[model samples]
Target: MIDWKRNFLMVALSQFLSIMGFAFAMPFAPYYIQQLGITEPTELKKWVALFTAAAALTLAVASPIWGALGDRYGRRIMLLRANFGGMLVLSLMGLVPDVKTLVILRLVQGALTGTTTAAQTFVSVQSPHNRSGVVLGTLSAAVFSGSMSGAFVGGLVAEWLGYRAAFMCSGVLLLAAGLLVLLGTREEFVRPVEENGSSMEDRARMFWDKIGPATPILALISIMGFVLLFDSAWMPLLVQEINGGIKGAAFWTGSLQAAGGIAGFLAGPIIGRIADRISPPRIGKISAFGAGLMMTVVGLSQGFWQLFAGRFGAVFCAGGLDPVFQIWLTKTTPAQSRGFVFGWAVTARALGWMAAPMASGTVAWMFGLRAVFFISSALFFLLIPIITLIARYLQPAPQPSAPIHAGRR
Candidate 1:
């Protein structure tokens, strides 16, 4: 018998390192770009938008292919591919001579790396159906904790060494993560048998049929993903504005992001436990509203401490959104099709990720950086009613009892 708990622990640890590695240098991108000689505000914002959107676009295209491969091969191998690919790409990011090359590398990163999706698919496949909420939530907590540690330490690293050095450190962390997963985790994936001589169209049709039931849930996940990451690319710039200059801005940006990460870390498992018992839709509604309220506070705050407080509260509530939906998706999907479905799930979220930057970047360019927060807040609020509607739609129709039969006599 598989030791699922051991498997979960190992997967979680690897996820932590992977996310930490990415966060280490990524959150400092705007400043790094400044160092590359693009100092004008509008031009800077455009490049920042491109940097985030480019990866998301490619990830959207690539995730489903990778997911299908995961099912055909094994999820564990996919995990290894993502980790090692990220290790290669992120390390090279530090060596790029200009911002254009950096953007190109990000595109490649999106194509080659998707550690979160790989990790989630691996854990979901191994975990008990009944305990999906808790398992996934704990996994999310590992991600948040990783982000907290990475951002905190990375900020200091960026401050003392330079942004390039931070990226190098990130590469090393990814190397460690890749090794951990390779040595520690094991999967008993059995490949599904293909029908003899099935055409590409038949396979595509079958794929959609399997994933159809979860479409609404997938849509919600995408929206939430977009809302969650909408303001991230420009956050360092916001920190600079609050600090009144670029000097020491990276450390403070990292500190603020760390605050959010810590909040997410604390909130994930607790909310997940609650979701497993209580109605996940109810939890989702409450979390969305709370996140929106807190985001308003973040948008309106004029000082660093105020922003920090708001960031903590915002992420605390926002952290519950994805795992709750994931739990629902996990329950709805068949075990055999999970890798396939989750690949689409990742694609959906990547679509959101792709859109967020372009939309938020536009708002930032037109209205100002703070305006992006307000827009993000509104998007969160919009989810409340959407969740309510989706919950109602997903409810099974009441079945009518057959008429009482006289044949019993």
Candidate 2:
């Protein structure tokens, strides 16, 4: 009776809006710190690292809890919470009195807002399992497309109206997204009877038990998440360096990210379809190698256009990494426990996100900005062997043969 296609379309639309809202102001964070009066380059870098890591730290802790709650309560509610929470936090971010206040808000943002994870879990629960690759891939495309639109428009908004205005616009978009989800999507989530009397400890143990078999895949997912985002916080600074000043730096950073978003938008569904047909491990290996190569080019680039070109290629290939792994995870895990497992998956990725800024910040602080890109490239290459080793674990389980009747034609 559930109209899954309609549900997917609605969820995808909400996801696009949600990610667009976040991207509007987030890519401009380092510059926002400057507006908050941290002009010293070292101080700026340190604060940037802190700002980026703070959210990841809390999200890492909060995701599994939210995920479990999604299963117990309803995925739709969790999706709404994420969008609405982001709307509030991001709006407040534009009004922060100081860098510390902004960082505090960022921490809150992480704890409350994980729209991507929430949306993905919601869609995963609703859609047919066989179509997971396409469904999730298309959802990822929405994310990339949203990011593309957000970054492009946001750059111009920041350039003309200033960073605060960009944050305000982000809030409005999230509000719209939340409303869309609230009114448009439907989830017939039946509460699991066993969860009613389960204590917190019992729930936690059950969650782990479901997730235990997928530990190896989740571990790689975490590492890949770190590799994917490792250079993100420092990218704005790199653009500044390339541009040779603050003038138009915000626009250029947004433009560069927008370019990558464009590539990711195109790559997501294509790579996803391919992943559905081919072995995800094989796709992962190829994507990782290409991403590493492109990242190296990005690191060595001397100008804005060169960086843009490299980023486009890198994002195109790197887009496959998450969706492919997600497809693999869906295939490996039990259906009923997906929400809990995915929450932990978000936690694993959050851990990676948490570590990336700190590590990249240290590298940029000690060596230089370009060094961070090189290190990120190396990490991408490292995933190749890891993916190969895990391919066995990710293989689809053998099916039982149909029993033959003696005289059946």
**Candidate 2 local lDDT, residue 288:** 98
What's the TM-score of every candidate structure? 0.96, 0.94
* Highest-scoring model, TM-score: 1
The parts of candidate 2 lying over 4 Å away from their true place are: 195-205, 393-409
Misplaced by over 4 Å in model 1 are 196-201, 401-409
Q: Please give the RMSD of candidate 2 to the true structure.
A: 2.7
- Candidate 2: clashing residue pairs, number: 0
Kindly list the per-residue Cα lDDT of model 1 for residues 349-401, writing each as its tens digit.
99999999999999998999999999989999999999999999999999999
* lDDT, model 1, position 143: 93
lDDT per residue (tens digit) for residues 328-349 in model 2:
8988887678888999999999
How close to the true structure is residue 174 of candidate 2, measured as C-alpha lDDT?
A: 99
